[model samples]
Target chain A: MNWNQIRTVYGKEMRDALRDRRTLLSMLLVPALVIPGIMFAFTAVSLKVVKKAAEETPAVMIIGPGNSEPLQKALAGSPKLRLVPAASDYAQQISDKRIRAAVEIPPGFEADLAANSIATVKIYTYEGEMKSSFAAGEIDRILREFREAAVTRKLGERGLNASFVRPFEIKRQNVAPPEKVGGNLFGGFVPYLLIILSVVGAMYPAIDLTAGEKERGTMETILCSPVGRVELVLGKFLTVLTISLSTVVTSITSMALSAVGLVHLFAGKVGAGAKAVNAATGQQLPMVDPVGVLGVMVMVLPLAVVFSALLFSVSLFAKSHKEAQTYASPILFLTILPAMAAMLPGVELNAKLALIPVLNVSLIGKEMVSGSFRYDMMALIFGSSCLYGAAALAVAVRLFNRESVLFRT
Target chain B: MIEAEGLTKVFRDKKRVEVRAVDGVSFRVEPGQIYGLLGANGAGKTTTLRLLATLLKPTSGAATVAGFDVVRQAHEVRKQVGFLAASTALYGRLTARETITYFGRLNGLGDPEIAVRTRRLTEELDMGEFIDRRTDKFSTGMKQKVSIARTLIHDPAVMIFDEPTLGLDVLAARTIVRFIRDCRERGKTVIYSTHVMSEVEKLCDVIGIVHGGRIRAEGTLDALRARFGQRDMEEIFVAAVGGESALARQDVPPATTR
Candidate 1:
């Protein structure tokens, strides 16, 4: 293949692709704006919803209120859960969803507590109601605290230490640094989104260059030139590869920047909340490492080439733009399945899994972000993907040379 | 110079049934001459031209352009021949000058040579006014000019035109005819295909009447008129496709370049 001729084809296609409105929108504008915007908005919205849910005061009714004034006082003192008026039929109130939950304190509960006997307090809540569940949890916590207080008082009266009631204490710790922890947490989602966007960005230009050329009657003119079929296919392939790679790069960069900004914003609020417990905990959310970003970009390169070649070959079969779209849409689902495979729990990056295309990239991306490096698996992933890309490119060049495919009616 | 020896093409559909689109067709046109190929629709006129252009390979026989065999030296043959069709499609996003330069570079012309040729072809085709404008908004005639410029960008020794004026207006058709005459004046071999009888009569030095994928008559216009005892070219075409019954069944109206 002549390099000059290939460059000429590449240059012309780039000129055409750059001028296209839809391609510019999908490649530059969408990744630079839509992706980061959507991720940030989604994160912000979900965080706000969770905070609101935690802070909201949901009403609960106390049933059989004649015997437990101390229990009632304890319940009213809880900051998050509010005690409403005792309903005559509190079970009806819980079932009707008017109240989130109701607590039942039997008539002999104070005598039982004075005699140091076991007594049960029943909590009723509607199943599957979020606020109802929250209320139940709050009431359970208050009952536990009241029982603990009684135990401490009884122990002190008997001249025994409160420590005698405890057998052992359990403590948990995480050894991973912030970046690795962040990588492990958000790794699957980030790679999945990046692969999806890369494929999407490559689709329009692939169809435009191959099938679009045929529809426009320019394919004949180009084919009639002195350039070889391989050169033609490579020229178009590189053009598409550039677009797909740029898309992933821009999207990942913007998403990373926005995530950092969001982390800073949320850290302030969370740090204020953390001051009540431990002040340093809120600002420690992990980030994707710079090395991990570079590794992902490299690993995804072959996959992008695969998508570019596959779309080119498939679109070459189509006689028109609409038909090309029909031929190309199924590829999205085909790639989505493997890209999402990394999101599943217990799916590790073993040698066998590394041979898989999109799934391998995703799993390896997760590993890279988590600060795990298996050079053998990375090599296998990269080499196998290169083979796959070459194979697809061969098919594309073959299809391009076939007059039947090129001039199909 | 151009030559063909019983060039044929067979097409098979999904069912594997074969149809001979071009069957043992043969003709020749020397340098400085225009060979007009005449036929009714589906008489293999376009197929024959495509085979000669190396766009479609002949299932049997052989063709050569400027001494290069189409099958063995397709790239060389392509470098020496320029093919044009009636559609005259241009890249809508590319300006006329860019379109010409793109084809020139693809044809292996250097940058300076491509520039020089683009300028010359633009002037020759009368496309200087809209040379820098995108073709999406171009009229049919302006697009045809760009098409002609791109086709001749490499200064190929042979030209192949397949009903290039089929849907063109009179003014545009006249421009193409004049261009074909100029190509021959520059000592370029030309193979022109159309059902327009007057174009063949006025422009072609030699005429080949193709029917059912085979040449039924091969001679100059007067020679065909004398041999077939017919004065009108349409009647000559009717005879070549098997006389009046075939003429009665022609789907496309008889095209006259009057």
Candidate 2:
């Protein structure tokens, strides 16, 4: 096919799409707006909920008369947990609902502790609550610790040590790369967006160029031109791919930007031996290297094209603009199946997944997120998708030229 | 320059009955002449033109347009023919000049040649100023002029126009009639379809009246009038297409006439 003719058709359709303000806005502006908009809203709401939960939890009141000094110190050092000492107004405070929970200790608590007799601490709290239940559970936990310490001290007084009761403490330090750190957060839905976008992007131009042209009554005029049928179909198919690719790129960009934002939002809630930001300077601490993100972008491209072409082929089966839309709707769900399958947490990225479109992309994206670049699997995904895209594009063109498809009207 | 021999097309679906849109239709048109296919809506005038344009292939028989078979050499047929159906079928988003240039490119013309032809057509059609404006924003007459410019872009040897003057004002219709006349003057063959008898009388060198999948009459106006024993072409056309039943019955007392 002459590239000039293809360019002519492509230029005209692109101009047409641009002229349609609504369609143009739907394509570029929607993605630009929707991703950040949704992310911002969710972030604001999440922060609000967390802050509210912290605020609503009643302060922990320590009522131990003696031998519970260590327990009081632990509660005092926790910045997140508020510490309130038992007072004369404690009874009135409980009755007035001023406190969600309180721990009450008996007078001979220290004597019972030294004798090693069974000692119980009274804990008071409200019934049937949300965060208050966790608060109440925390109060009981401290009371249990105080009792254990008293028993340990009593054993010491009896000329024996509590070492036989327990072994040494256990500690684990995770040294995964920054990208992997982010992946551990979801390991679920983050990668699926790429697959969704490529399919959506591929579908828009196919339906618009084929069915849309028919609806506008321009297809007949186009067919009458001396332009070859193959050229016409290819021009339209390319437009759909371009649209789908742009969407995929935009979604990925949005995802990356959001990832950056989320990384900063969770600056303190992460591991060490890596530079953690103080949340003061917006400067990134280089948690995940730039190479990993680039790898993810490369990995997503092939899968994007494969699914995009699949959508293109399915859309070509439509006889009219309306029929094309109906033909395209079901394929949206089809993409979701692979997305769901790829979402099993702790699943490993492997070469066996290279044959699957959505699953392969998700795996590769996962690997990229974790700062692991598998060039071979990356090549397999991109090569297979490009091959699939070319095949799908050919089928779409053939369907377009078939007398049975375009001439049905 | 253009001919159809026993051309036929059958349309079918799973449940509905089959439709013979065109049946054994035959006709011929030499260069430097206007051949009018006159028929009512759905009378197969447009279908016959589409078949000749190679937009749709004939189910049987043969059509050779500009020395190219409409079936075996369909692309060649398209290369030589400029087809315009009743539908304006213009891309709403493209400017008139861009629309013409796009078709020129499709015809495989070089950029400079496309530019030259587009400029010449725009000036000849008296659409130079409006040509740069988006066609969707054009009036019916302006749009009709652009559509004409589109068909003329490839400079084909044969022009197939199906109801070219449809929904056109008097002035627009005049321009189209003049364009067809110009095509004939340039020795280009044209297969024109219209239901307007005056258009046929004034411009067509030959006329074919099609009805119910058949050509009811084909000849010069004089020949048709002589055959019907009527001087008026409209009266001949009325009598030719089984006549209008109401007018036919009203022309005589039913029982006595029977």
Candidate 3:
């Protein structure tokens, strides 16, 4: 009830938390370093590995080179595929990774093709191995080119054009802006990280401010002051919220910078690899909009409060920091499950889902960051989250006032 | 002034068994008087003090501190009372001054007033050297001084000391004993709890001998000696709680065994 007392507690707790190495690690350093660390490893390492795999020429063995001289010649002419001598151990070689893949040309394959008969060419590969997959892909490409050349020759002999085989063309284009494309790509990921970091950021301080006080014998001293239980809880909750928000902000900024740096760094050096990444994401590696980033941060505020209060309440039940951690693990997992639910395909923010606590924030956050704002749903989720936060805070205050809990032995 | 009438506290264990941590206990301590509640550990001494300090509500009966009901006006009672225990500790990350300033603000003191009181307590407790340093590195005596300073920051009228010297070395214990005496000299109503008979004999103006959650005997040290016909304070305490069986189990010196 007393604002000044709450401010005093908040300021003191913030100062104390800032000085604590554990809290600082969770709040600032870990998120800041971890996001960039992960991003750098994910982007740079993956790009290098994929580039190497694509560039490395994998040896291939043709089972029947005599049956298809033109096919064999075309495969040999390709710079990406190296044709090895026919051998009985070609399958063994593929399995042992000595050869990346093997091609089985059926008997009379050229005759069957010239007679317009269907024949299947089997491409043997080491499944799931990157290099073998790349080699198999190269063989498939060369086979398609060989078949296409034969088709064109057959069409010309019949006095037909290449277009005679095709009726119409299918073309596709992305209507959404690049920012939305990036948002759609990273939306689930960014909010997932922010929500998790926010919860984790609140964890240590919530435990320290409540159970740590009990462990250190400062609980009774603080409780003996004129500050009411509500005020005390509010002050501690605000401190936790402040730290949690700082972590969210730090991680968002770190991830944004890392994404931008990685995009620029690899865009030129690994142009083809970058294009592959862009193709995988279905965009040109769009930058996350600054406005959308700010919006996500704003949307995460109420959710942070919910986490802070819940963590504070759960940790207050424990009598020591270690016990508090034990008590808080379930809450962490519980928050994570709902936050991750938003990342699931087809899990969109709806009227029903918006009423849920963490899931709503995540769903709405994903949408908000992707340049979509359903204000009604946003207001609903925000309001519901605020309600949950208030309820959790009330529970924390109630627990703080309970003699059984505060003086638990 | 402080008063209590038939105060009691009951707790339920994990097995659903009711345990009377504090029974019907009554006492009075006027301003400028030191009332010591002498009992062995877990004898409801801490519970009784906690009840009067508004840290815990009583299951029955009532108490008042500095003209405020401990339960209904708990906030006001806390504002007027300073409570400390040997178990109560300092924020290790905070400097002594910050700790004092924090508690002062919690007690509803303004910045200027807190500043003034911090200076006075710092000088009076002789904490000038360590006041600006973090308490995690402080010795027991220094930490206890900081705790005391924090307790007295708002200058409450009533003081509660619950085994404040329990874990201290001789010098630190002496400092606490001196602080209690100073509280009495400043016209503050004080309730001190300890199992140490020497502390009662040396500091208490009135002593309440507590046992099994009840006050078994209440009077001055001289009055208790006269009533029990025992010269030594330990003998007087033994006689007050239980006559001969407790005396056999007690570990006091052989000279005071009789």
Candidate 4:
């Protein structure tokens, strides 16, 4: 192979691709601006919606207001729930979302408690509606407090303390560090985006360099040169790899900056409300580890090569740019499915899974981001990815060498 | 020098039908001589030139260019030959100088050599006005000039042009015809293929009348006219390929179009 010729081809292709607006959009603009823009928009909207749902005071109707005057007074006195007048069509009102929930205090409910008898209070709500659900939860909390006070009064009558009913306490805590917590939370997501971005980044240039040349009638001119087919393929492959890696880096940088900016904005604006929002959603703002992120980027290298080679090989079968896109669509979907499979809950990477192409990279990337390094698995994944990349490159070279494929009508 | 001993190329279509694109073609052209292979659209003229240029390997038979076997030493053959087809195009995004320099480098020329060749080709082809401009916006004539410069950048010993003036305007076509003549003046072995009888009469030192993937007649314009008992070159071509009826049977219009 002629290294000089390869460099010549690579340099020319890179310059050509840079001048192309389509390649620039996919490799730089989309990953750097569009992705982070969508992420920021989605996060801001969801947080705002959650916070609104938590803060809204919803109206509730008492079905038997006269039978439990004290209970009605207590419900009306609470700040979270607004007691509405007695109504027979409480279910209809809840369904219409006019009233958040309805509390049915049974007849003689206080007399049953006074006689130490069991009575059930049914709270009706609009299922699956966020505001209604919040209202129902507040009503339930107040009812539970009233019942506990009654129990305490009963204990006082028996000359006993409230501690007699409770034997021990249970507490829960997380042992993992914040970085691991963040990694575990965003691990599946980050790798999935990076893998997809890498593939997307390589797509246009691969199609443009191979099939685009054929359509433009430049393939014959280049074929007549002294450079070998293998060298030419290598040159083109390296160009695609460079664009693919650049896309991933741009996306990572954009996402990191967006994450930091959003974190700071949330801290400054909502302060404790952000924590309340996180607690309500069972998610915390993740603290990304710079070193761990670097590790993930390192692991993505071989996989990027694999995507570049595979895309090039597939696009070479097409005779035009449009046809090349058709040929490459299936490959994009195939990679996506495996990357998504790695994101499923309980889908941990095993020895066998480490040999799979996109899935292995995604799974291992998650671990790397979480500050965990299973070197054996990492080596296995890296080696297997390299093998796949080499094989795909061989296929590209072989296809490029075939006159029938190159000059197909 | 260039030589072909029964060079042939076969292809199979999508329906599994076999096609002899080039069949048992034999010819020779010495340095400084212009050999024109004249044929209609699908008479395997392009295939023959492609085989000689090492763009496509011959299915049967053998050929040599510049003392190297086309099949066994394709890389060497490519290094020694400059090929330009009418369909061949330039990289639209590259400047004319860059395009020429790129091919020079691909041919293993050093930086100093490429720079010198780029300047000379630019001057020779009258491309100085657009040498530093991207080729996408150039006129057909200007682009053709750049393509010629790129083809000759390596200073190869043999030049193969396959219908290089197919779709050019009169001025552009004249430039290409002049370039072919210039190549021969420089002692380059030139094989020019076309279906135009006037080009053959005016340019080729030796002419090969090709029909159905085989050369039916081979000689100078005068020799062919004498041997076929025809005064006009087109009549000589028509008679050499078989007769008027054979041309009719092949579904080809008379060679008067281009």
Tens digits of per-residue lDDT, candidate 3, B1-258, equal 999999998877667677777789999999999999998766788889889888889999999999999989999999998898987789999999999999988887788999998989989999999989999999999999999998898889999999999889999999999999999999999999998989989999999998778899999888998999998988888888897686455442111000
Question: Model 4 segments beyond 4 Å from truth?
Answer: A114-117, A277-285, B248-258
| Candidate 1 deviant stretches above 4 angstroms | A88-98, A106-108, A111-120, A124-134, A153-161, A261-267, A270-284, B247-258
Model 3 Cα displacement at A277 (Å)? 6.2
After superposing the true interface residues, what Cα RMSD does each candidate give? 5.0, 8.2, 6.3, 4.0
True contacts kept of 4: 0.81
TM-score of chain B of each: 0.94, 0.92, 0.94, 0.95
Tell me the tens digit of each residue's lDDT in model 4 across B1-258: 999999988877667677787889999999999999998777789889988888788999999999999999999999999999887899999999889888989988898998988888888888888899999999999999999998898888999999999889999999999999999999999999998999999999999999878899999988988898898988888888888788667743221111
Q: lDDT tens string, model 2, B1-258?
A: 998999997766445556777889999999998999887666777778878887777789899999999889987888898887765488888899888888888888788988888878878888977888998889888988888888888888998888888888899889888999999999999989988888999989999987766799999988998899988778888888878983344321111000
How large is the C-alpha RMSD of every model relative to the true structure? 3.4, 6.5, 3.8, 2.8
Which DockQ values do the candidates obtain, in the order shown? 0.52, 0.38, 0.52, 0.57
Top of the candidates by DockQ? 4
Cα miss at A37, model 4 (Å)?
A: 2.7
Residue B19, model 4: lDDT of 77
Give the TM-score (vs. native) of candidate 2: 0.83
Question: What does candidate 4's lDDT look like per residue over A1-409, in tens digits?
Answer: 7888899999999999999888889888987889778988988898889778777789999999887877888888899988889788889999998899999999999999999899999999888899998999989988998888888999999999898886576666667777788777878877888888889889989999989988898888899989899999999999999999998898888888887888787765556775775786565656556776787788889888988999998888888999999999998999899989988878999999999899998998888788888999999998998898889889999999888888776
Q: Which predicted model would earn the best lDDT?
A: 4
Give per-model TM-scores: 0.93, 0.83, 0.94, 0.95
